[model samples]
Target: MDELIKYAKENRRLLHQVPEVGFTEYITTYLIYERLSQTNFNLYVGDDALDIDRQVGLPSDDVMANTYQRALDYGVPCSFLEKLHPYKTGVVATIDTNQKGPHVVLRFDIDALPIKESNEIEHVPFKEGFQSKHDGEMHACGHDAHAAIGISVATYIDEHIDELTGKYTIIFQNSEEGVRGAASYAKKGWLDDADYFLSGHVGTISEEVGTVGATATNFLASTKFNVELFGQSSHAGSNPQDGNNALLAASAIALSLNTIAPHREGATRLNVGILQAGQGRNIIPDYAKLECESRGETTQLNEYMFERAKEIIENGAKMYGCESKITVEGFAPSATCSKEMIDIVKSATVSNDAVKTIVDEVSMDASEDAAVFINIVQENNGKATYLIFPYHLKYGHHHPSFDVDEAVLEVAITTFINILNELK
Candidate 1:
């Protein structure tokens, strides 16, 4: 455990030095492969075998080509790599134990956000002078840690696979930040065979340097929407009344959307993230587009809120005499933790003297595509749970200065290894 912790600390510093965003994690993925190769784990990359163009979205095709070539260079083995749709990079690896028992699936998100790195002195890559070369893309959400932690767990499981009693699948998922990655895996039946599923996030909120925070029982289900409005364009001064204002309709929808929040019980959230309209202020906008998200603790409430949003958009457009279209970009289901699985994780953590805290809470405001896994498990009549390890940091998640106490990595590694041992 001590040696693994030391390894994680050293490796985490290196990973932080070079933050890569989303499916464009060419260098970061290579480094992970290089590190994990030394361990007993059977390394696999491009489990879906997606072509570079389909996996990563960049402004330049040349860059995507190069990244795809680099991933191919690693030559990780897998059964298939589908090149069907090329927007996300997804990988799946299977570790089968000859012995018969329940199969388990574990997932980790491997994408970074489109934010700049902080210039803080304690910020690793920045202090060491290895900040991102690609200006705006950074691992502001601690995904680099998630990747490392997943690798550490995979390595540990690999070394101990001979003594284990079941099969394990380690998934390296891409595009979690944008909420567009996991659906394909779920649809492809990647998790169909698993009897149990587990995943965790590293948060700065727990404050306990190396403790596992709340075993969250329920997380809000969320859906992303892109709305486009069409209206007649006319010169503002010359013919103001001749134009139907799409911008006006969009604004009305945004304002009226907030009215639905007070109607829901528990925590319901809504946000309008992106808005683009008009070329010039002097011209009545011909088209307006807005991207928004709505979330709720259950599917019923989520659907209800979504229906209200639809009404707002439809009615607002009619009132403004403009045409409107609403597109659901993506949807992630809510997560409800299984008591039995939570007990397993809690028992594992409590039994380990090194674990400082074990929290049990029902609500986590943030949404995870990992929830898709939990939903799959429950649907299959299996129990599942998700855990979080609190790593003390000065700033909140998705912030530029976001940094985690590296010591928590050890605690996570220990907890994962212990859980695997107990299951064995």
Candidate 2:
């Protein structure tokens, strides 16, 4: 157990030093491959593990090329780099015991956020010399710890292969931060063969170190989209009327979007996170771009918000005689955990001394791409659940100062090992 904790910690710190955003985790993928390749698991990479056509919200081609080049400079083998080219960045591994039993699948997200890290000396990572090396990228959401726990569990399973009976599938998913990556695999029917499925997060609603949550409720359905408005550019002083003002159109649309009525049935949210327009003070802006998203407690409500948002954007652009293009970059459906799986999680760790408390459920009140995996498994008549293992957090998720208590890493690994044993 001590050695396992050490292994998880080492991997987590190493991952912390190199953070990458969704759909472009080149170095992240390379490091995971290097660690898991030594084990006996049957590994699948890139297009072999995903249906690329289903993927959305991918970075631009230039961004992908630069990230791949960075990975090469970081010493990733060219042969391995070839496997992840063309915007594929997920890894899946499976082990068959050749015994008749359940097929259990476990998923772990491996993408980082775009927020820059705090360089304060008091922060544990900064104090320990493992602060992020990449500018404007940090693991502010604990995915690094999730990936480490996953690798630790995989190695544990490999060492105890003779003691476990069921066929096991492990997924290291990418682009989960934006709710984009899971669909690539889920739509490909990756979870169709599972008898049992499990996935979760760290330092969510709970804040106690030894607490484990069995189920999550109220996962918000969400859609991320980008809008571009185009108009003719002209000199502001000479021909203001001839040039349609895309910037003015975008401003009106953003105001109307924020004023959309919330669904009476449940909570709804909308945000225009980014709005860029205009080239110079003397020239009329010919183009404007808006990065926005809508969310709701349920899918129907989310559609209400999205549809209304679209109407506002389109009509707003037309009101200014501008062309509008709205593209959906990512989406996640609302989901809930099965009671049977929740009970299993509770029973699996009931005897573990490390787990001090087992809560039946908690309000997630956020979006998670893991819903893609959980929903598919349940729809196929298999049991699935998204658990929460809480820890002391320095700041809220996606914040620059966000960090997790290292002890939670071991708790997560131990809990999964117990659950796997129970299923076996």
User: Against the true structure, whose TM-score is highest?
Assistant: 2
Off by over 4 Å in 1: 34-85
Q: What TM-score fits each model? A: 0.88, 0.98
> How many pairs of residues in model 2 come into backbone collision?
0
Most lDDT-accurate candidate: 2
What lDDT is reached at residue 348 by model 1?
69
Indicate the residue-level lDDT of 313 in model 1: 92
The regions of model 2 sitting more than 4 angstroms off are none
- All candidates' lDDT scores? 0.73, 0.90
Task: In candidate 2, list every pair of residues with a backbone clash.
Answer: none
lDDT of 1: 0.73
- Could you tell me the TM-score of candidate 1? 0.88
